[model samples]
Target: MASLTLPRHTGFFSGSLPTRPTLRYAAPVKVRMSLSESGPSIAVVGVTGAVGQEFLSVLSDRDFPYRSIKMLASKRSAGRRLTFEGNEYVVEELTAESFGGVDIALFSAGGSISKEFGPIAAEKGTIVVDNSSAFRMDEKVPLVIPEVNPEAMHGIKLGTGKGALIANPNCSTIICLMAATPLHRHAKVLRMVVSTYQAASGAGAAAMEELEQQTREVLEGRPPTCKIFKQQYAFNIFSHNASVLSNGYNEEEMKMVKETRKIWNDKDVKVTATCIRVPVMRAHAESVNLQFESPLHEDTARDILKNAPGVVVIDDRKANHFPTPLEVSNKDDVAVGRIRQDLSQDGNKGLDIFVCGDQIRKGAALNAVQIAEMLL
Candidate 1:
């Protein structure tokens, strides 16, 4: 018989957001409030994309206070209709002029779009919480994961502060940190080795659609579509499609290393990662190996994760069940499992674990909203 150990966690962790948050849509927005009426005037910069759609869902789920909200996208998407907060909205083409009178602009457009307009929005006094890599590495721009580093963005708030930009870390980085940070706080991680199984959703809605179309085509004995990826992605796994750096690490992998360093505000920690895009539709999974400066027992680690905010423990050894992307889809909390001490290192100084989270929700939109909430 296989060894089976139920998570059996004792308590919850602090310094985190709500766990298992529901993502149901809000009732149709009955009335449209004006920017001058009350609450903050908001803008969704990439209102038609995947993460963009998620931003709307999260905003409604949390009942984020807004006197008005603008759905801004590319020229092509202008005039398209989207419903939110019980109200119907026509998408507007984002431009230099869109940020006027907007209080908080949630940006989910591609890097180029964010690169151009993020600064513009900030210059116009609109606080921009950008969900792209565009400004994450900018020293002056505070990269934030509200659960882990809210203070990194201290002094900025809605309605009362000068316009500034805050960068949301990559989805993989966010999900990993949600689980790892609690443990790191206790054990002081000295080195980290991560292997990721990413989902098509990380690529974009097009990539996700391609996967679905290709899967159907493959089942029907047709040639699989290969539009979004260089290779068939429906039922096959491949290395992350990000450009390879001189160090042989892909951009996605490098983001894990660099972002972890910045978010933790710890420059001396050693980290490495190998990222692969699996056929999963929505969430990302990671196998994280850690070497800690202090001893951390496996049982104690489980208890810490159990109590940690925004972390769900699913380590079921008897049933051989653990965190899966399917279970975490559209969920707010990151699920952690496979916790065990690394026998390779003496003195209980190392351990291994698995983590999964919805790339679009906690990894992107929900996270951005959480940071925005802290400012209020």
Candidate 2:
């Protein structure tokens, strides 16, 4: 119920209506509100996207504390309806004014939209849990994984006129680090060499459809056209998404490298990643080789991972069992298996591990919602 003054800037207004203003707060203040009695009023931006849909599902499944909910999307998706908590809510067009009186806003739209509107939502005294890359690297914004950094939310000011925006890490980075961070605590993670097999869902709804349609055409003995992807996505793998930087790493790969270091707060830790898009619908699997500051045996490394939080160790060589994308799909916990020492390297200093996680849940939607829950 507190408001901050907006600076007079040309970009702050479109035509007649004053556009949302960017707000800055010295510190967060909590207003005396009974969330238990009335629940928190919440809004979801980009409600039509895959991650947005997952956000809705997670909120309902987890019974998040919310009194009311608003669904906002692009003009094309406006008037569409989604059911939640046994009630239907119509999607509204996203605009500067859409976040009025919203207690919390979950953003899953592209980075540009998040950049333009996220600050506006924060100015209106709404806490934003953003699932985009826009604010992840911002020093002021907290990139959080609830299992690893719930304490990071302690610094967030909910209602004191400060726009609290927390960023969720990239899907690949989130899944990989969820399995690796805990192990780093016991043995200092000196370097990480990782390759990712990502699902089509990571690209978005259209990419998923493209993979499906292309697969169908190939099975029917027809020519398959690639649109959502630069090349055929059905029964194929591609190493390109966005563009490859001068360093030969694609944007997706670089995101994993940079984000991993930040999340672990270990700049000295070395990380290299190769991200590939596979034809799977959901879940992402990673093959990781880690070099530790202190030498750790395979059994000891496996024990640390087995007892790690948000991790399920599924290593069983005799039964030929290990974490797979299909098995970990739709699951929240990161699955780790195929634990071994990298004999290719001298000494038992390096460990090899495989991890699988639902890129939609633990990677994006569920993680953002969990951060919100931690704040509550």
Best model number under lDDT: 1
TM-score of model number 2:
0.89
For candidate 1, write residues 1-376 as lDDT tens digits: 1111111110111122223213321123233332245678889998777788788767776767887888898987777665555456778899999989988999999999999999999999999999999999999999999889888987887767589999999999999999899999999999999999999889876787677778889989999979889998877999999999998999999999999999999999999999999998788999999999999999999999999998999999999999999899878999999999999999999999999999889999999999888876
Candidate 2 local lDDT, 296-346, one digit each (tens): 888998888888888999999999999988787667799999999989766
Candidate 1 residue runs with Cα over 4 Å from true position: 1-37
Instruction: Estimate the TM-score of every prediction.
Output: 0.90, 0.89
lDDT values for all models: 0.85, 0.79
Scored by Cα lDDT, where does model 2 land? Answer: 0.79
